[model samples]
Structures are given as C-alpha cells and as structure tokens.
Target: MDRPDHDRASAFDADSRRRVQVLVIGGGQAGLAAGYYLRRAGLDFAILDANPAPGGAWQHYWDSLRLFSPAEYSSLPGRPMPHQTGAPYPNARHVAAYLAAYEDRYHLPVHRPVHVTGIERSPDHLTIHTSADTWHAQAVVFATGSWQRPFVPAVPGRELFTGHQLHTTGYRRAADFAGQRVVVVGGGNSGAQIAADLTAVTETRWVTRRPPHFLPDSVDGRALFELATHQVRAHAAGDTHTGVASLGDIVATAPVRAARDSGLLAAHPMFDRLSPTGPVWTDGSTWDCDTIIWCTGFRPDLAATRALEDPRIHLLGYGNWTGPASATLVGVGRTARTAVEQIRTLLG
Candidate 1:
C-alpha cells in the first residue's frame, strides 16, 4: 500500500520512522530472493532498492548482454522466468521485465528509489539511513551488490594516460568506438563479450592476467549453478574432492562463438604497464589504442555494513561469503532462505 507523496512526510518524520522487523538492503537478485523467503516466514520486512525501478543490476548491463542460463534457471523462488520465444537465453531487457513482474506477483514490499547510505546500530536494533527515509530495523541485511563498486587495476602510468578510459560501468556500445582501437582488460566473460562486440566496429586487443579458462561450448550457467550447489552440499558433508566449472570460465555466446570462428578470441597476457597512449606488453612492445575498457569485476558494496558490530545484521548474495555464487539469481535463493532462518533464530 502506498501513501500519497504529500502524506509521506507525515508518515516518516524522525520520531515516526517506520520500524520493520527486518530490513533487506538492495532489491537486486539477492534482495528479491531474501524478500521471498522473508514473506513466506511472515517476517515484517521491507526491501530497499536504489534503482528507480525493477531489474536490479540488469538494468545497467551492456545493451548486448545475455544470460548464460535458460529461463527456468534464472527465476526467483516461486516464479519461473516468463519464457521468451526467440531468446533461448534472455537478455538484460527480458530480466528487467521479469523482475518487475516478480515484485508484483508476490507483492514483495520493495521500496524503490530508496538509496541506503549508511547504518547506525543501537542496543536493540539498527537504523538504516537512506537518501529519502530513515528505517529502524530489528535486523538488517546487506544485499547491496558489487556493480556499484567496479574495480580498476592500478597499472603504472594510469594517471598519465591521455586516451579514453572507462570501466564496464560506463561502457554502452561498440559503435561508441567505431573507428578507434580498443583494449579490453580482464579475463572473464565480460571482457570476452565486450571484446567481441567491439570487433565488429573497431580494432581490438584483449589483455588478461592469464589466458581465460573456457567452459565447454555446450555448458552454460545452469550447469555451473548445479555444480556450485553440489559443491556446497559436498562441503557440508565433509567431502573434499568435488570438481565442476565456475562462472569465471567463459561461455561461448553467439558473438563469442563468432569471434572464435574468426580467430578473434586471442588474449594477450597482462601488459607490463600503461603508456600515455596504451598498454605496453611485457615483451616491451606497445599497442596504440584510443580507448581502454576495464571489465576487471567488482567488490561487494559492503562499505556501510563493514561498520556493523551487531550479529543481528546479515549480508546475502555476495558469493561464498554469504553462500555459493549467492550473487547470481539462481544461486541467491538458498542464501536468502538460510539467512532468514538465521535471523529467525536470532530474533527468537
């Protein structure tokens, strides 16, 4: 239920801050999963998302990005991702649409346009401060994902480089660099995909710390999720010898497949340094590049949570730290369920 914007002020004055039993920070995949379990448990929880609307981080992914998993594998706890006829693997738009509907289907009490800035802990509870409102929560969860905090390596001469430089956060399209030379840094799928995208329009170089590990062409994220799950179960049972591919290994999407067919998947080892123009390879050679795109991945956005001393607050959907691959849509359900149960016990 929504109050009029005019009435919201009276609804949430400092002394009248709405208190929730639990507060889930972030409304992305992990946050939604947490909301699902929290609702089923009948917990008085509210999810706060910074995004203006649904779709979480998907809304910000590159235009050509696609999930490596099928619809059935990319769904939330109770809802299956609506199947798209042509997109065997859904793209960013498809995911954003599904998330918007999922929020409605369950009527998850997700508050959007609510950007959490920090948290303050008191003897009995936590106070979550956001851009618009302040929330007093008995228990808090940190599901704020990593995309907001992209990682850029500190290569030598980084400051002196005069060429265009950007992290994947700002990269929009290959056409943006149509006639220029592009250097894509990172060994992961993002690097490979972006490199592939740029190949259509520009001269490209891919530089990685090491040669990227590629999963079998037939294998995709679903298989990796299952493998990760099995590993988690095996670990619980004290079995040590488990082997399966991980998300870090690149999957050959259509563009990547085409790149491979055309012998454009070549990746050079990390350059020794950055020159004013481009990367200088360890071999003392340099490539002239007009732009450098760093797909170097992200760190968990736990800056605020890092200050918490309260065990009542939990963080979900940030890889094995919260649970296995907990950041991914399919992988978040278990973590969220487990976290809610822990919170339930703590509350008891």
Candidate 2:
C-alpha cells in the first residue's frame, strides 16, 4: 500500500492544530454507529473516512448487487433505510443512498477522502495521521470495518493470464462481462451472488475450497434475523469464534437445498493448481474462464496501530464496542445496541 502524500507542516500551525476529545477512524456503518452514540453524549469527536461519502463498504459493491440482509435489519442508529420496489433485499444503490442519508440525518462530522496513514500514541494522546491533516485526541475508536483490504490468492501465472481478473470490489455490472466465460471464486454470499449475476450474460462457475452450506432467505417458521439474533446473544454471553460456523450449521438444518441445484450454477472444489489456460480442479478436471472474481472475504488491518500496547483492542466486539473503555466484535450478523449500552455505562 502507498502512504498518503500531504504537506503536514503547511496544513496547520502549532497553535492552530485541530484537536478533539475522541477521534473515530473510518466513516462506515460501524463508525457512524459509534458517532451516533458519541453525538448523543455530546462528546467532541471527528470521523475520518477514506471514501468521499458515508455508507462505507456498501459504496464499493457491485452496482447490480443487493444486500443479503433486508432493509429492516440493515439500518444504522437514529435512522431507517428506505424501502425498495423489488424484493425484500435492497440493491446496492439503495444501500449507498441510505448510508448517505444516515450521515445527513445525524449530521455526523466525517471528513472524506482522508486516508489514514498511521496511528501512533503520544505521551498524552493518540495521533491519527491522514492524507491531508493530523488529528489529535485523548482517545481513539477504530471503526474501519473488517473489509479494509481485499484478499486475492496468489496463483502462479496469475498475471500472465489474458482474462480479466477482478476482486469483488471492482465488479460492477453483468454487462461488463457479457458473453464471456466467468469464474466466481469463494462460496460466500458475495461469490454466490456474483455467479448468479454473471450467469445471465455469460457462462459462470462457482468454486470454493470447502462446500459451503446454503439456506433460504427464510428458515424454520422465522426469518434468518431471528436465528442470527439468538446466536449473537449466545455468543455474547460466553461463546466466541464459532459464530460463523454455528450460523452455517443452523442454516444446513433447513430443508432448502443448495442454490446450485437449479441448474443455473455449477459447484467445484478448491482450485488445486493454476495455469494461464485455466484453473485445475482437484479431481483433475479443467474449467476455462475469461474472468475471475475472488470474493474470498477479508481480514482485520490493525497494522497502523500495531505499536499500541492495548490487548483490550482485540477484545472489542466486531461491531459492538462497550464504549471507549471496552470492546466487542458485534457486527457479524449481530446487533450493537447491547455493546453500545455497555460502552455508555463504562464511559459514564
């Protein structure tokens, strides 16, 4: 990654430096959620986001894609996402619009196009260096969600291939790959959805390392949200790390089968070997593709704050933080209200 270039000395004078009580890094859903609470408490804070607008990760999704979660469950604090005309799942554009609205509604102070270069702790405060300015604060909250970086597996001859290769972030619409052989890698929701979308205009194949379990949008006399909430609560009580695995297990119990069974999709195991020609399957089968879309998921980037000697930082819930004092990762299909309440208590 490239470090941002900014004339730090010319931007602010010694006495005119901008300072806040708290600095929130990232202006995505998580950051906005935290900002909502902070605003309610009348705390002096500022949010720095890399994107030009709010809604964070949603803005980077494919234009044709819709959220896997319905609008009801997707709204942030202090605002409701508007309904769409189609299925319960709102499309990507709607989500982006909703996020923009959330920022406007709450008047969240988010500085856009400000890439965070580094996070360092001073003797009396934390300094957040961005592309254009440096923010000083008594405390810092990292709301830079888990998807900061895209993971593309390294395959020999990957660059030599003539086909168009893209991570899920760069994917836009099906028209871009019309009439081409497309391979959607990773069995996660993004991979599945991208495969489904491409199939309309091109020959598509879905590949995964492990056969992922799929469930209908609805399950067992209740919505998936209900089940997800129950699981989240259980995890919050004590269990951790098994939340994703547990959700998959529960989804497998449903009578609904894999979406691939509809003849619209083909399932293949992990890519064993790769050549410029195509990816070789474990069974010695070969599949030719003109385009490769990797939706393999993401990892948390704490490199900027690696020097901070805070073990509690890792304990913060995914999307749920017990205020600035405690942390919990609560956003992977879970609500952050309880975590927010906990933070309020600690801060109070």
Give the alpha carbon lDDT tens digit for every residue of 1-348 in model 2.
111221221234446576887677777777777777778877787777777555678777887665545676666666766779876767767876776677667777777767888877766766778888787876666667666678888866677676778888788888999989888888776777777777778988888877766664454213444544665567668866534344452232211233455677666787876667678866878887788888887766455676545421221224333222112112421233433444455445
Name the 10 consecutive residues with the lowest summed lDDT in model 1. 1-10
Name the runs in model 1 displaced over 4 angstroms: 1-15, 241-248, 307-309
N/CA/C clash count, model 1: 0
Candidate that scores best on lDDT: 1
All models: lDDT? 0.84, 0.64
**Using Cα atoms with residue i matched to residue i, what is each candidate's TM-score against the true structure?**
0.93, 0.81
